[model samples]
Target: MIKKMSIVCLMMLFISCVKTKEEKNFFSNGDFYIDYYENEILIRRDAFYKKGNLKAIIEFKNDKLDNAKIYNGKKLVSQYFRKNDTLYDSETYYDNGIVIGEGNVDRWCREIGWWNYYDRNRRLFQKQHYVILNNSQLSNQVLFYKNGLLDTLRSDIADIVFYKDKGGASFKGKLIYNRKLNEKSYVSILFSDSIKDDFSNMDSVKFDTITFGDKAIMEFPVIFESNGRKNIRGIVVEQYAKEENVGDKPVNMLERYMYIDKKVDFH
Candidate 1:
């Protein structure tokens, strides 16, 4: 009777394993499949196309984004990691598995710092330095040629000059506009805790009311809050008339932010 009981227990365990396997393989809503740990925490999410081709694989830890890999059929197109859902580092590959672009994206979903772009032959063709501008949808980009020279022809920024005086260090930037400006356009320079992260507590120090121009020059004196390094942010606000068919939209406002870093010089 004891031997018979042991055999029955083995059969039940085998059945349970088979059931779990079948659930993992076929339990899907037709587009994606999810797997969970024993504690019901989601471990992996596999997304598929309508024809059952795997599209993406996203992994999570503690219910937050950890890393994600996107694919085009059997080829990996891009992969990125969001540690703690804050920092984003991403890399994209060509269809032939050659790395095309790689960069870090800030919490605001804007690309920050330096980003490299490669040609199809795996050679570095260009580099871009992205900074927060007044318009959250847009970023000021400083471009570089493959030979490491500044590519001003392709860069959005014209010129930014910094200087030191008796009061403190100050900066001025020349903005070249593609179209003529009106009276509603202005540039504001502010002091902020960070140049890239958050801009809520910024203190405006200087502003320029630009009217009727293809170019605007904005400058402000820098005031260091501490002896350590700090960041300065400049915002260019451009306003346009209300467009038709846009429901209740008063004005089209576009803002961009330019970032600069300075350190206290005791000498």
Candidate 2:
């Protein structure tokens, strides 16, 4: 019988190579969809809950978001990884899964460096420290309690403040109506060459040119020249105005950096 029809065509090619197919699609957060499995491998991307069940699964590879879990019924609570695509490594649990919080986000999604919190008896309580700078500024943040003390420091931008004059490198600053500033402003102090250098080459070193009277907090006095191997790097803010007649150019608007050894006492 032609060798039993060649053993039934090798058992139908091993049952079509173990069959597996899914193929779902459209998921730009419109409540999730993406699934694709044997069609080309997208692995997961699901979300449900309006009478259905499962809430999140995410996982993807060549498509991006590498891992995610989140659930409530079967209890996974939360999870994250995204090895690359600008960083994510997150975590969060507590629905019995414990973990509470853990972090490292970047690609403009802020939150970087140390972040840990836990309580439902896992103890550790709180601790966040995101100092970030040229990574697009989170510029400073600190908090830590649960006995480690320190508590709060946060400040993403109050527009400008500086104030340090420890008998030397000088600084006395001000500016406040920040909605990005512009009642005639232009402050500078750049000066890099490393501390992670990024202002495309940094050099300015000193500048003022203010103009916001009636006590809208204008104060200014910048004085620079600390080249004992250079270090103060950051504090720009510009925008001096001149609409249809154009003349006194300035425009840039805000840049801040500190903590490369705590320059100007940005402790």
Candidate 3:
């Protein structure tokens, strides 16, 4: 994704610009609060709460880092501008305040141009193409389908698809968990319905929906015959790379979304 965030922004571009002569206005360590005046740079961080109120707000000037906002109580959910060290303008929100993920950044901070993503009832799912191909920097994204059609989100597996504008590749499509869905956000992979149709030559399938730390896994679709490939699948779930051994709990079940080929278990 964005080439591993440009290799972690070239390995932490200056931390907070260093400097540090201490011209501070305010700085806290309890939860997060900063306002420095060029002392060490950074003007805001951490304090991002929700439900319990007091979302976010950070501002500073004489030190080069200014502007910040992230709220859920008053609405606004994101805002940014941490110049100099890079990270020019960023935005993201969707708890009702709208605005999913606008964009900015470049001057080497990376993530530049056309970044717009939405879908909390706002539609327009994705389209982030932060160019600069040969010079190195890149981003390339583009998905949509809340009816706007044209979708394809597969930046390395757990696939996703939706198409049909008119051009012929066969038209008429259907496979999003077979229609009527809302599994709370979905996470159900359970494999083995007689191996679903075999699919050799290295079978594959994925509808993408992953996250394991907080639990939200959905990567299913692996049905390779010849006596191998089944059980759990990738997205970062090691198990000898698999050939069918699966059992210790981890599960995935989201068929018809067009790739969740039966042997589910993201262990």
Please give the RMSD to the true structure for each candidate, in Å: 9.7, 19.1, 21.9
Query: 70-150, model 3: which lDDT tens digit per residue?
Result: 676678877877655555788778776788888776544456645778788777756654544334554433345546755
User: Ranking under lDDT, best-scoring first?
Assistant: 1, 2, 3
lDDT score of residue 187 within candidate 1? 46
**What is the TM-score of each predicted model, taking all chains together?**
0.57, 0.32, 0.26
- Please write out the lDDT profile of model 2 over residues 110-190, one tens digit for every residue: 666557887878777576545454345443434445455533343223334566677756777664433234544443333
With candidate 3 superimposed using the best TM-score fit, by how many Å does residue 129's alpha carbon deviate from the native?
3.3
Task: Indicate the residue-level lDDT of 155 in model 2.
Answer: 24
Given candidate 2, what's the lDDT at residue 221? Answer: 76
Clashing pairs in 3: 20-39, 38-63, 177-257, 188-252, 188-253, 189-252, 189-253, 191-262, 220-260, 221-261
Q: Could you give candidate 1's per-residue lDDT for residues 145-261 as a string of tens digits? A: 656565655654523344556555543333443222344455443343444453433343343333332234444443444554434344444444434447776556555445433
Misplaced by over 4 Å in model 2 are 1-35, 38-56, 70-73, 81-84, 96-99, 105-112, 121-124, 128-143, 146-267
Model 3: how large is the Cα RMSD against the reference?
21.9
Worst 10 residues of 3 by lDDT: 233-242
- Which parts of model 1 have CA positions greater than 4 angstroms off? 1-30, 106-114, 127-136, 142-146, 158-191, 194-225, 236-267
Q: What's the lDDT of the predicted structure labeled candidate 1?
A: 0.57
Model 1 Cα RMSD, Å?
9.7
**Residue 62 CA displacement from its true place in model 1, Å:** 1.9
